[model samples]
Target: MSGEMTQGCPPTPEARAAQRARTLARPGLEAVRVKGRLRANKWLLLRRITQLGILALFLAGPWFGWWIVKGNLSSSLTLGVLPLTDPYLLAQSLAAGHVPYKDALLGGAIVLAFYLLFGGRLFCAWVCPVNLVTDAAAWLRRRLGIKGGKTPSAWTRYWLLGFTLVASAATGSIAWEWVNPVSMLHRGLIFGFGLAWGIVLAVFLYDLLFASRGWCGHVCPVGAFYGLLGKTALIRVTADQRRACDDCMDCFAVCPEPQVIRPALKAVGQAHPLILDKDCTSCGRCIDVCGKDVFRLTTRFDRSES
Candidate 1:
């Protein structure tokens, strides 16, 4: 008190006003209200439809006795003609020294081709049933003001991916499916919701309270495998209209993988605005949140900035 100023009892009027402004900046859906909610949420709505529709296809076969698709997410035969298999699962089987049937090999090849062209993590955003639970948790986390508790390194999933293969080799069987939430949820939906509810609820709670994006973003080996497949994907999200960005930060808040946005959106001297990161899930949340329409889905070859 003799030579220095004492701390104030409370923040000044100007500081309070600045704090208020910062709080208000978290507009959530209001960030896109000016663009019309329907237009802004178009991608989100489409994604929901795709996710539910795929689930319906599988459920229809078992529940309604309609065999449109005759298998779980791991492997399936559509209309008894088209076979689809999870390439990741096939890799595990091979690691376990199990040679898959010819149909399974062909199915994996077909799936590998599709993901190679359209982006692999598209499965996470558009098809996986567990995504519904995680998205709901994320939504509730934001509304409840629950900041993430702890975030693990994103590379943890890659290590887990390797562990899955090594575990398969060591056990001489596909081991991850024993605890994979996606497989459990799918089986629960088809069979009965016994232990599946516990798995799904655990994931929901994990993302809601434990970490911001703990599962798909940090732990899921399946997602890690698919992300590697998408390293050279043809389809990508591009910040085509990045010049129109007004620094709103809404996209960053909504993106599951925010790190992928920077290089494309703020490439000071770079001519292109393509989000080329393999980790991007192509979830379209960025497109849904940006009021300026700064982002869009396009092929990697089309790099002209808007």
Candidate 2:
């Protein structure tokens, strides 16, 4: 007791100022200046436009009766001609002992073919409305000087994906839909906002206050399913210009799946500079944030470092 300090003292002014300075050193600031603000944020702007445009297509039918698309993201018919369905939902229906209609089978096949050709996580980056919510939370957390809280195991989502399928089989129902925030949000938008707002808000707070990239990165089973599908995707982000990199780490900071970048960007002796990780969302944030333009979206077949 005698060795311990008698009273807790507040941090000195200099210490407080130093903390502020450290927080102000946000990533991509240098890149913004060097690359020009608009050029630096090019991919981010495209992603926002894509997300909002998809939302508009869905909303126009329900809100204005334009009827461009006739359902939510889980299942939809465009112009009463093009049918699209979530393959994961189709799988759940099968596990629940239900034979989907021929149209549903065709829709699922169409979606599967698209993802197999491109990248499955493209859904997460380009279409999922929930991505906007999670991204806002991540931005706020960075601004507020938030540090580590709870880091869940990356494998948790795969386990949850397995559990959802098993539960569907055992209960004869699509068990995950009851708690799926994506469906809830879409339904709320078309009908009326209710519990969907609460669910979305909870996800935002969870990421901002408790964990970094928690929901999308660690807990979403939907993302896990798509990740598995993307294992052999033809399109990918390559670090072919990695030799020009100045080790900014800005790409790592902005990347939702930062672990995927290291092998490609830092592979000194490796033959390829392609990011082959299935978890890589192909979001193009690295391309936007890198001053040296180290990353680019290209075919997986391109292996040349040039």
Candidate 3:
């Protein structure tokens, strides 16, 4: 104890300064490493949760085949059929040949009504069966060594939407709903007694094995509709950085939608750090992925960032 106390009793000025610097630097480096590890774990957990949820829903929804979950001839007859099974109805209504306001309009109105109430979040984050199926496919794709991919070009959805409307107009029956895997699977089971389910499941398995949600972000008409409506929604999640960013670009790399990340990057280090746009699904993944705690989803809207 006497020898140790003597050694620690005093230090040269240079040694003390060196020791101080080491102490400060160690904490900073450790903090960075800890933050990075935590961020990685957070995203990994989020992806796992989303994938499991999707798998559960896909396995359960059709297995139960509840009337509310399963659309049938009634959906075709009363809800306005489209070409897949009720195409004649979708066509008649869209073409102005029949009053969609009276029949098919009910579904569309119900959708629009929900959007107005909840800010159009349902189709993307909740309601769409195709989205659920595609999420599962994406999870499988990741399991098969596909690490990450972006939604195709922004205009992809717009073109698809236009094409769907035009095709529906031309055929005098909407066809988008027919090619829809969700609707197709439903009809396949009801009409072909699960043959449709088998074929659809095969396609889904293929998508999972190869591509990542190839059908949802780029091809789904309903997603396009929700996207358009979501543009106007009042609630938005965004990134915020009160301090100077390190410019590590970790947030951008982890972002699911790169286009929106670009703009967010431009705003960083400036007055506004979080300028979110239409591409944001508000999934909050970015928030979880930011190691420096730069991203946050807050209701306090700042116009400068917007």
Candidate 4:
């Protein structure tokens, strides 16, 4: 008896009832009804607007003859003046033995500086077009409760990031761009939907059936690169009012990177309230779903619990 493992007790009836109550109500269902749909979905709606708006600027040139923006997501000159280059893409080019012109470097710096200030995966939540597809897949996954997917290591993305650079150097080409879903998604819409559609669909299904947030959180090298870039970002989601948490777990359900929340929300010292984890998307769904208003967007310098 001393050497053998003992059986564990089942959950108490009260605990079971609580679980039932939490499960019966969808995450943020109360917030949706009580806060009104618009207010409840404010951050999400804003994200959709920003994501679509950026895509619209890119699409305008081809679809509407506007030419307001030139080139694709990899590199672009907005209004023939503002150069926005994806620094990660530039890294791949350099690995492939290509030195871009000064504008490209400058554009990369501009983006790098922005994410350094505002957090990196904000790009994932607020601007990337494939995010729309992934978000839709995540929403459907939650609604359907289709669980039991593969749990890949989140570190996989970092490894993939390293692999990409090495692969580019070895092959003398930007290897990841050959299958980069973000670039494919952007170009597909601009040109035609053929292979891009498949890439997007594969990503959608990968997240839905294989893992929850399997790609962006655990597999995408771009996210891994941006995460490293914004590790010390000034902007962050802070659990300032965590004492008000009633164990609703809505924030956990909705967060893209749920792993980042627990320490900030439940840490012994309330002074450590900022979600400083680089994987955090700064998506604001935690703020939106928490009826207690426990989370908010604030700078890392802000230690004020108020």
lDDT of 3 by residue, 1-306 (tens): 011113336655565555444422222232246466565456446645664454343334456643232344214332124211233234434663445545445555554655544445334554334444555665456444554454456577678777777777787665576565656654554455355566567657655654355555455555666666666555555555635344444444334354666555565444455544554555555566454566666542554432
The models' CA-based lDDT, in order, is: 0.86, 0.86, 0.50, 0.84
Q: Write the per-residue lDDT of candidate 4 for residues 179-297, one digit (tens) a residue.
A: 99999999998998888888999999998888998888889899889888778898888998988766667888888888889889998444488989998988888888777678889
Q: Model 2: clashing residue pairs?
A: none
Query: Which residue pairs does candidate 1 place in steric collision?
Result: none
| CA displacement after TM-score superposition, residue 259 of candidate 1 (Å) | 0.8
Better of 3 and 4 by lDDT: 4
What total of clashing residue pairs does each candidate reach? 0, 0, 7, 1
lDDT value, residue 136 of candidate 2: 88
| Every model's TM-score | 0.91, 0.91, 0.59, 0.92
Off by over 4 Å in 2: 1-25, 268-270
Show model 4 residue runs off by greater than 4 Å: 1-25, 268-271
lDDT of 2 at 45: 92
Indicate which candidate wins on TM-score.
4
Which is the winner by TM-score between candidate 1 and candidate 3? 1
- Prediction 3 TM-score vs. true: 0.59
Query: Candidate 1 — which residues are off by over 4 angstroms?
Result: 1-31, 268-271
Higher-lDDT candidate among 2 and 3? 2
Global Cα RMSD, each model = 6.6, 7.9, 11.1, 6.1
Model 3 residue 121 lDDT?
Answer: 39
Residue 100 Cα positional deviation in candidate 4, in Å, after optimal superposition: 0.6
